[model samples]
Structures are given as structure tokens and as C-alpha cells.
Target: MSLVRRIMHQGFMPLFWLALLLSAALGLHQLETLFQWIQPDTRAVIYSRDSFLSLLLNHLSIVGIAALVSIVIGVGAAIAVSRPWGRDFLPLVSQVASIGQTFPPVAVLALSVPLFGFGAVPTMFALILYGLLPIVRNTLVGLRGIDSSVLEAARGVGMSSVQVLLQVELPLAMNVILAGIRTSVTINIATAAIGSTIGASTLGDPVISGLVNGNTAYVLQGAILIGLLAVTVDSLFERLQNSFSVMEDRLIK
Candidate 1:
């Protein structure tokens, strides 16, 4: 299992990201010069101390945590609603998730600030709300779209409800669920930079600082890194979904 995981890690996804990584490497080398061009007209200050890797890692941690929260709640709520007893709550769950997202992330951050204080916590709360709708919507769609015959066959084999759900239904629906996650994480990667406004250290820190201080260089730096991070993660998720599809095909054969 460990060997399989290692192979999947090293051989599977990285192959898709080779070009993106190379581009980022090249961009990092010219990051300072790139900043100068962003505002040649203005006396923009470029602080070269913060490396792209450092900023990227900080951004990753913030978005990573919030995405985890989103997946747990979004997927769990969908699963619950798919169950017989919880089926009645499907509309309610869907509506509530819609409402949560309709409330702006900035507004959510403002509300959470009083309770959580100014930090990543409020930012994470806002993003968790932001990421919920797609995941829940997708999971519900995936589970509901499953073929009845397949489910009945599992049940005919004496599979318990739990076994059928865990071993059969979820595995079949895994790619759909993961697609939702892919969307959520990609969106969050760009959105979590807002956390910088409230004191969370992220790639957005430079952007916000630039906006406030009128230094276009900082904004350019943050924007480039955030865009690259989003692309990197989106590629990884795309590769993962492809891998799941291949695995599913193998099982069918």
C-alpha cells in the first residue's frame, strides 16, 4: 500500500504538472523584474525578501485547511441527504447552502471577525461557506444518478446498508465527489488570499499591502503566485480524477 501510494504520488500527478512547475521556476527567477513592469509609471516598492515558495506554502496552508472543512461538511451533508431518513432535508440543505454562498465572503469575514478575531479563522470560515454549494450539489447528483440495478446487486449479495454505501455506492460516486472538490479547492485557492486583509499571512498579503500602499509591485507578486498556485492545484485534481477513471475501468474489466 505504501509503495502504491508513493508511486501514485511521484509518478501519477507530477507528470501533469511538469510544465507548470517549470514555468513557475522560470517566473520566480524573474519575479523582481516582472514586478517593475507591473507599474513602471509609479514609484512602486518591490520587497524581494519573501520568496515565492514561502508565499506559496503560506497560501497553500490557508486554502488547504478551508478546503478540508468544505469537503467534510459538503460531502457529509450530501451523504446524509441521500439517506432515506434524511432525504426530506435535501431541499432545506440545498437552500441553506445556497444562502450561505449568497452572503458575500467579505461579509462573512466581517461577521466572523467579531467572533473569531482578525485572522485566518475568519477567512477559513468564509471560504468554507464559499466552497460548500458545488460539493453538496455534485455529491447529491452523483449518488442519485447511480443505477438501481447495481445497488440491488450489492444488496442481493447480502451486503449490509453500511457496506453497500461504503464499498459500492461511494466508490462509484468517488469521481463525481472529487470533481466537486476540485472545483471547490481551485476557487478557494484564489479566494483565500482575502484572508490577508484581516491579518492572515498568505500570498494575498502582498496584494493587499500593494493595494493599500499603492505599490503595484506587491500586487503583481501576489497575483502571479496565487494564479500559479491555483493552476498547480487544478492540474493535480484533474490528474486525480483521471486516475480514478482509469481505476474504475480496470474494476469493470
Candidate 2:
């Protein structure tokens, strides 16, 4: 298949999800009667405190920031510990990342609130902490998975350490690293919704409000959007991973 055609084919599903997500967010009020049925006793079936689009954007921003930070720190740490000179610290770094992952996101959020004081910052802080494990672990797996013979060959070819890492090691390990990123981001998307409980403006707001007010309609609305968003992102990552695999195959050939 032509590159353009292949690209389009791979992109189709994500585009479809994006369209559905937009339609649901924008046309939510049109389903008022349906929501009313879900929460028959509530005066307001629609979530009117904020638009779904705004909440979605806020949620994405929070996750995006956290994911970016996590990627940088996680990837960097893994790379550092993978180096010959840094090998002694590998166990320590892994332990730290594992501990961070073991910490409950809700507990992190609650703890950060006192320091960051109730906003997107604390939520992001919690997300970054919770999201690091997958990324760090995957990066380590990717880097360590490289064959020693490959590195020896690279060095024999007169490639500098940096050159081998940048040109060969990274290229080979990219897919695994990306898989980690996908896992981290997907988890963050779901966890970020919980930020609403701590005063962060997120899709979780409706769900929290719904629970507080005993309105199932509000809860359903938030859930639908969050689920759609997660699927969309996951689809996007899958497409990216496929593209990377194709490129790597081409390079190998």
C-alpha cells in the first residue's frame, strides 16, 4: 500500500472516536429526555455546572502535562540506570519507581493538596507520581533487552557511545518505550477524573456531583465521556505503535 493510504487507513479509527467524542460532548443536552429517564426524580438531568467540552479539555491538559513530565523523568532515569557507569544505581531507581506506583493515586492527591493547595497542580502532581511506574519499567525493559553483541558491533564500527545509543539503541527500543507511554497515559486519563474530588475541574466533577446529589444521570454523562476519551487515546497510541513497527521493519529490510 502507498504510504499515504496506509496512514489514512491507520488514522481512521482515531478520527472516528474523536468525532464521536465531540458529538457526545456538544450534543449532550439534546439527550436531556434520555438523561431525565435515567434520573427521573432529579430536576436537572443534564450536567449544567460546566460544559463537557471544557471539562474534557481540562482533563486532557492535566493528563498531558503529567504524561509529558513522566515521560521525560521516567525515560531519562531508565536510560541513566541502564548505562555501564550508572548500573549500580539501577536497583535504587527501580525501587523508587515501584514505590511511586504502589502509592494510591487518591492518597497522593490528598497528600499533595496540603502542599499544592487544591487545584490542577496537585492533581498533576499525583498523576505524575502514579504514572511513572509503567514508563520507567518499560524503558528499562527496552534498553536492557538490547543484545550485548549489538553494542559490541556498534563499538567495533567506530560509533561513539552516544551515537550507538541515539542511532541504534533508541531506535530499537522505541516501540517498547512507546508502549509504556501508552499504558501510563491511559491510566492517567482515568485517574485524572478523580481529581474533581479535590477541587480540580475535570470530567469527574459531574460524577462526584451526581453521587453527592444522588443523580445517576450526571454520573452516566461523565462516565460516557471519560470512557470515550480513554478509547480514543488508546486507539491513537495503537496506531502510532503500528506505524513505528512498520518503519522499523522497513529500516531492518
Candidate 3:
């Protein structure tokens, strides 16, 4: 066990080191372009620093809001449909989530534009729709997967339904819930790039610009950065899930 722990620690150390190195490299590259943008005399390949920052902030905000909204609605929907009163509604909700996933983001934007107008509203709506399935489905799966014995025991102890859910089911199912949130967030990060198509500024701005101007370098830069960000966030969530799993294991033991 000590040897296994040592090996795992060694593996993690190098992995973290490499991630830090790559992050620093990307940061330096971004900084160099930023410095060039601010220098009036320097004509950089990228646009002005202010423009880049604005685009980045706009994209992040829209994506962040969309992901947040999706989490709340998706988790709520999951919990609702899990209960006996709402069980019959599960299929309908699942169908809706499926439809949302099947619908093209571009199509959602097109339809939403008429109702919500241009800018972030349409984009955010589309993102939330696109990002709901994993979270909702996972929540259902997690809740259902809980051991029946534990639940019965809780009920036998005179626990109310709410108490059983809060103290037993939810705690046991939290890792799965976190996993769903992680998946949703990562998917949103990628889908958020599509928001740029509807004039919602985001990291996708550079990639779109690159596509228009045939700037492979800029497209690569944007794509790589977005991929890296998604991977990092997903990894963080996986770690969190594992931590919860460990705690649950210890409790069970």
C-alpha cells in the first residue's frame, strides 16, 4: 500500500508539473500578444488587448451564466422527476431534454433570435438547452442507484421522506450528481463557442475570425485554449467526485 501510494504520488507530481508548465507557456504566449497590442508601435498578429479581453470576458460570462442556469434547472428537474408524484413526468422531461440535444445550436439561435432578440439572451438559452441532458439524466441515475436497504432503514427509523432523501439518498448519490455537473460544464464550454455565431462574443470569436480570414494559427490558439480549459475543469470535477467517493467508502467501512 505504501508503495502504491508512492507511485501514485510520483505520477501525480509529474502530471501537475507538466500542466503548470503548459499553462505558463500559454500564458506567456497570450501575454506577449497582449503586450504587443498595448504597444502602439507594435503591429501584432492578433487584435488589440482591449478587444481580446472584451471578447474573452463576454464569452466567459455568457457561458458561465448558461452553465449555472442549466445546473439549477437540470438538477431540479431531476429531483422532481425522481419522486413518485413526478415519476410519470420523467419520460416527458427526458424527451424534452433529448429534443434539446438533437436540435442544432445554430437552429436554436435562429429560432430564439425572433423571440429573445440578438446578443446573449438567445445564446444563453440555447446553451442551457444544449447542456441539460447529462446533468438531468445523471441525477436520475444517481438517485435510483442508491441502495434500497439503506433507504428502507432510514424510513424504518421513522425518518420522513424529506429526511430520508436529505440524509441518506442525497449523500450517497452526491458523487454521481457532481459527475453530471462536471459533464454538463465541460459540454457547455465547447458548445459555448457556437454562441459566437449569433454575435455573442466569446472565445469562439477568435476561431470564427480565424476561419473567416484563413488564419490557422489563431484558430488553433483558440481551439487549444478552450480544449485545455474544458479538460482542466473536468479534471477538477473528477477529483471532487473521487474525493466524495473516498469519503463514502470510509463511511461504509
Where is model 3 more than 4 Å wrong at Cα?
A: 1-43, 49-54, 98-100, 104-106
Using lDDT, give the best candidate's number.
2
lDDT of 2 by residue, 75-182 (tens): 988999999899999999888877777777778778989899888888999899888889999999898888999889899999999999999999989999999999
Per-residue lDDT value at 103 in model 2: 76
**Can you write out model 3's per-residue Cα lDDT over 163-211, one digit (the tens) per residue?**
9888888888888888878777877777677777777777787678768
Ranking of all predicted structures according to TM-score, beginning with the best and ending with the worst: 2, 1, 3
Number of clashing pairs, model 3? 1
TM-score of 3: 0.79
Model 2 weakest lDDT span, ten residues long: 1-10
Clashing pairs in 2: none
TM-scores for the candidates: 0.83, 0.93, 0.79
Where model 2 places Cα greater than 4 Å from the true spot, the runs are 1-7
Error of 1 at 40 (Å): 5.5
Higher-scoring candidate on lDDT, 1 or 3: 1
2 versus 3: better TM-score goes to: 2
Query: Sort by lDDT, best first: what order?
Result: 2, 1, 3
